[model samples]
Target: MKQSRLPHRFGKERGRNKMDKFMDNPWFVRIVAMALALLLFLSIQDLGNKSEGSRPNGMESNEVETITAVPLEKYYDSENLVVTGMPDTIEVTIEGQRRFVEATKRQRDFTVYVDLSDLSIGNHRVPILYKDFSEKLKVKVEPVYVEVSIQEKVTQEFPVEPEFNNNILAEGFEAEQPIVEPNRVRITGGKETLEKISYVKASIDAKGLIEETIKRDTKVTVLDRDLNKLDVFVDPEYVTVTVPVNNPRKTVPIKIKQVGSPPDGTVIKRMEGDIEEVMIFGWTDNLQSVNEIEVEVDVSEVTKDVELDVPIKRPEGINKITPERVKVKIVTDKAKNAETNLSEVPIESKGLADSLDVEFLSPVDGAVSIKVVGNKDELKKAQEGDFEVFMNMQGLRVGDHEVNLEVKGPKDIKWELSTEKAKVRLKEKGTV
Candidate 1:
């Protein structure tokens, strides 16, 4: 048994020795290592070729980027034509290599504009254009085409009328005519649009206005006849509106006061104003205290007829006065007098109530005697026809009434009437 087990063990040992001999062969190990190295090299080469083939035509990987708020420029015959309906800005999306996209977004080295140079005076569809960008970039604008209206350019002058809300003025206060600086404006626009222009006005809000002049910068608007706003260009877009607001006004007579006596050789025959009265605006209290406006005239230096411009004295709290300065004529004649008496000067009645009539009862001829005194030359020029004596029968009842006779004559003469009171009877129309 021992000899047989020894052979089997020797056989197993022989088989193990054969496998060890095969594993220890250097040429086989060298072949296996070479195969593994060749497989790894092939794999690396394949990967490189695939990567190079993926990028065709020497192009690089691309990315998409969007740029916003890019201003749009226009090119056309702007001097002779006006263009409208063009957008101010647009957005552009670009697809290109990462480096170019980033550079384009950062540097903004591109231009977007519209070309209307070839368009005529009418509606036109113009294409948006772009240039001065990287050649590798593909750009797409948000709006590819723009609609524009081309019109013939024209210029016209329009008066600027000031407008305001009158209801906003303070109570008991009134506004004079508003004054606009640069009363007219030159407007340039389309010829068709200009034809429709009715008015150009400067609007001011009178809200919260009191007894003061309101001055403010107001925007100008162009409108049509129907008050519809029109699209136009104004050279002066704004104007200054000066609204003069004040209290109620009153017109009063200008009283001429003599400050000094006339020259020794000359006497002031008459002093009269060119304008009889002036309108003034002031507070209620101040107006109530004022009855008439007075201007003082100095006659000490006056020897002959003289014309002077006298400034009106304004009361405190008065806003304004019309005809601030009045022309006064001072008539002086030589100190020589002549008297003339005219008898039976015809008398008249005036300002009688429409429903009543008056009849003169005392003087049977309805006339009076008048005596005139003045310079010899002036007295020679005077006549009975120059005098008007009448009784104002205003507000009298239908009965006997005693009315004073009013007389008017030349400013340079002194006139005396025969009687101061007139006896008259008043009666209704139907009864009389």
Candidate 2:
């Protein structure tokens, strides 16, 4: 039996029958099934990778983002109470759909703060809170909870001392006491913190080597006894400072001050120093008498030829020196050594009070004998005026006392006193 064809079914029946026949083929069926399965797997993979940021979703950091240095606002009784232990900034993490996350991070229209208006004076552990942001976004902040200290507000005045790095100044220069326009500053903070304030410094700043005077506007800082900075409100937070950096220099030579003796049968052939012109830094008047800078060395332990780095000692009146260390090459050789005895050298008394008169009791002539020992050639160059014998009578009163003998002489030769000390009697100038 044959079926009647439908209207407009001229090619419709043949197309449908051809499609049904094609589906019945095992090879064609397998190919179509494989294509559909592949399409489904691609769709699932695209969805799974959306959060990994592997592909751009037309937004920056589409899935999650971390915002740093977000200011942390504090809400408390600012007028009557002081709070501590809260950080000035926080780290906020925003996580949600790509659109919301990108919007929140870009706009940055959120607040992370702590509210302590309802609390009393004491320490309390409270959770940090946030507000004024998109509700669809999930927010997380580091240090979710904090321990805060609440105390009575107090205000006090602290003297502002100026501080600067004098070491950074130009060579052979000095910085005088810094002068602050207003020497004092007013600070407000917790009672405990105010009481712990130790230093209020107006730090002065300069660029590179400061040769001339420095004048600038700088901020004041409050610190505790341990030099730890304190968080507080300062009135007139800024101040003007003037630092007088002066270059009062004097050119001089270096003098070697030897302390010990050389070994027997060994003579110092020559001592050559690798130093040139030197500078002494100080006030104009203090630099007047500073003719040389002393560098001390010990020759007692020196047996063979060796090099020594001697530190240049700053004079009592000088403020600074150039070439802090001088490298010296010492040459030693075996030669004939001799000793020269200097007798009847008058001893001088220094640092004696003007109202007192000193008289040597044992050595009535106030004279001493010394033995200078060194190379025969070096000893021949020695002179009586080259050495100074003196006794420090700085703290002597109107009574008898024993004083130690000190010497100032050439450094290449070794010298010693016949007696270590001298007996002297001090009397009032007007007394018998």
Candidate 3:
């Protein structure tokens, strides 16, 4: 290239002098290089700022909506996993790339696991592992290791064979002892899970088992499957079973036990009930001790009624009563009265010494009412004097007599005696 202009004498001298200075002081040359590099960096930064401004603000991860995944159950160490410590729920946090995290509908899609098998017996720290991430997305779990303590495996023996613990079947119905193909099962787990175990229940629920031979593979399970297993290592796997049921039918008799008396002036004549016997159906063991039959009636609130209800009652300690109800009828009747009239009747007194004198002061005719309780036939013939009515007159001479009389009677009779004041002339009778 042809030189367009001649070098100035000062420029040439300065350039030459600068080259010499750089060669003499290397540190000065390094400082100048750094200054140039900083200038270039600033220019590039400015260009980037202009480009981003042309686009839009908040277009990065902040622009998109964020969603997180939460687990339903808590994660715990396996072998030593304390059932109590194990959480019923777990959660997965997804952020940064909102589209990728929100699009994952299930927790399984983003593999989440705590390696329990690798855990030691004692307390341990475990890390949560995650992978496959781009620059735009991120997982929040930094220190993924979680602290957990492992426990020893425990085993327990439970009766695997099914049994009807003293339960009786109704007549013509029997339980076919279940034959569990594998009688006993081995269950191994943590202590917490083992402690919650209930009875391992296996059942053969078929009707009409009396005198019948049946072969079936009954389904069996641990009562608390979450805690225990069906232990079936005992004899008689697939329970080879037999049932001996009898068609049991029996008749029973019932009686009554009277307690308190009826109200005063009232008597219970007839007490009736709904039934005398009740029918019962149950296992022989349950029905063996049954003796009495009872029924309930609305007699508890009975005060005044010609006909009162009598409820049947079952005696205590009886297993079952046949003819569960019965009707009891108690017949009752009202009392009757007997009357007598005596006109100048003789008043003969007993237990009187011969030294005393006696006379009749009142008119002999007197009326009295006598009440008696008995069958209708007996009361009709009952009489007043037939019982006894008397007054003592030995101490007085002939005189006007006014006195009330008392009457005595047999056990079944009641009596009342009354008369108007008597006016009899007085006279001196011979003294003793």
Q: Model 1, range 1-432, lDDT digits (tens) per residue?
A: 565455788889999999889879998799989999999999999999999868753477679988999999999887999987888899999998788899999999899999888888999988899999888889999899999889999999889999977787765567889999999999998888899998788988855656677898999999999998877789799999999987777888889998876654577878999999999886666677778998899887889999999899887766678989999999887778778898898788888888887778877578999988777777889888889988887678889878888998887678888888888888988785
Candidate 1: the clashing residue pairs are: none
Window of ten residues with lowest summed lDDT in model 2: 53-62
Clashing pairs in 2: none
RMSD of each: 17.0, 18.0, 16.2
Count clashing residue pairs per candidate.
Answer: 0, 0, 52
Provide the overall lDDT of each model, using Cα atoms, as 2-decimal numbers.
Answer: 0.86, 0.86, 0.50
- The alpha-carbon root-mean-square deviation between model 3 and the true structure, to one decimal in Å, is 16.2
User: Please, what are the lDDT tens digits per residue for candidate 3 over residues 306-373?
Assistant: 44345344454333444444555554444343444333323345433455444444554343333445
Candidate 2 regions with alpha-carbon error over 4 angstroms: 1-62, 248-286, 290-432
Q: Would you give me the overall lDDT of model 1? A: 0.86
lDDT tens per residue, model 2, 193-246: 898899899998777998889998989999999999998899899999999888
